[model samples]
Target: MAPELPFDDQEASTNLPLATQIFRFVVTGVGSGILDFGLTAILQYALGMPAGFAKAIGFVCGTTTAYIFNRRWTFRAEPSMARFVAVAVLYCVTFVVNVGVYTYLSHLWPETVLYSLLGYVIAQGLATIINFIVQRTVIFNIK
Candidate 1:
């Protein structure tokens, strides 16, 4: 078997190319968004949770997944408690913005089948932009 590459070696593959970083980030975000959206839909439609609250709950799940994958796959960073807590705090700040946007948009449009997805998308898009930028620059920077 081939010898395992060090964490830094794996990270260098992702770190040099900005395009690669963005692509990986977007892929990770899309995966987590699907999880988040699906969970929110289930909570709101099946369990009768309010749209805003359901979205908040779902965001927690998605954020957790994103942190794990982004740390391991996207950024290739070894685990650290300080990093995890920093991410948690960042997610908390983003959570409010995410849910606030969802709430406002959900109010503007009825939470019908189609509009529910749209509202989620719009809010997720905002959070996605914020997440990608900060995660790459501040939280996960290796250089």
Candidate 2:
């Protein structure tokens, strides 16, 4: 049987390039963003939740999906509940930021879906940047 490679070794087996890894990361990020936005839209439209509440609920769902996917596939990192909790706490802060933006935009442009979507994009953009950095550098430790 072939020898078992460490998680890092398995990650590098792609041999594609750093650019490829970053590209994959962005793709994964967009998938996670879709999850966030879909859930937010459903909660706000179907359930008639406030934009802030919908965004918070969506943030939890999206971040959980992101953590699981990034751990197993994107970063190929070992799992740790403690690390999950830490990352979750960080996500909560982002959730508040998201809610603030969502609420403001809902007020500013009460009649338009575009403003709500734009607010979500802005909030999620900041959260995604922070999530990628923290997951790669601190939580997952890709290097």
Candidate 3:
């Protein structure tokens, strides 16, 4: 017989209030965003890497950070391989969308700090929305 998982007995519904979840998510996002933006700036400005590549690396790092916190604190869920795979798939989609948006915005604006920040905000905003919704409704939903 297979070993029982820690979250196997968790209630099907997430008992936490939506507002609370959102608040936690936002807090987590802020931390993750700092990491993302900092890394992107270092790579793009200090090392002269291409903007898209820098942003991609930053996004992966930030998303990993978000996943760790969201799974443990925000959702109060135990780790599971299935959940990990689901999140990976979701991030894959968001990664494409995020990089595409950032790349497009980079082309439209001059190579300046303001433009880099702008592109980062827009792309990150879109990805954040998608991630929160999907994680709440599907991946982290204890069903």
Q: Pick the candidate with the highest lDDT.
A: 3
Q: Model 1 over residues 74-113: C-alpha lDDT tens digits? A: 7666777777777887888889889999889889987786
Over 39-106, each residue of candidate 3 has an lDDT whose tens digit, in order, gives 99999999999999999999999999989878876776777788989999999999999988998999
Say which prediction, candidate 1 or candidate 2, comes out ahead on TM-score.
Answer: 1
Better of 2 and 3 by TM-score: 3
Higher lDDT: candidate 1 or 3?
Answer: 3
The local distance difference test score of model 1 is 0.80
Worst 10 residues of 3 by lDDT: 1-10
Clashes of each: 0, 0, 0
Taking all chains together, the TM-score of candidate 3 against the true structure is 0.89
Worst 10 residues of 1 by lDDT: 1-10
Clashing pairs in 3: none
Please list the residue runs of candidate 1 whose C-alpha ends up more than 4 Å from where it truly belongs after superposition: 1-14
The CA lDDT of each predicted structure is 0.80, 0.70, 0.86
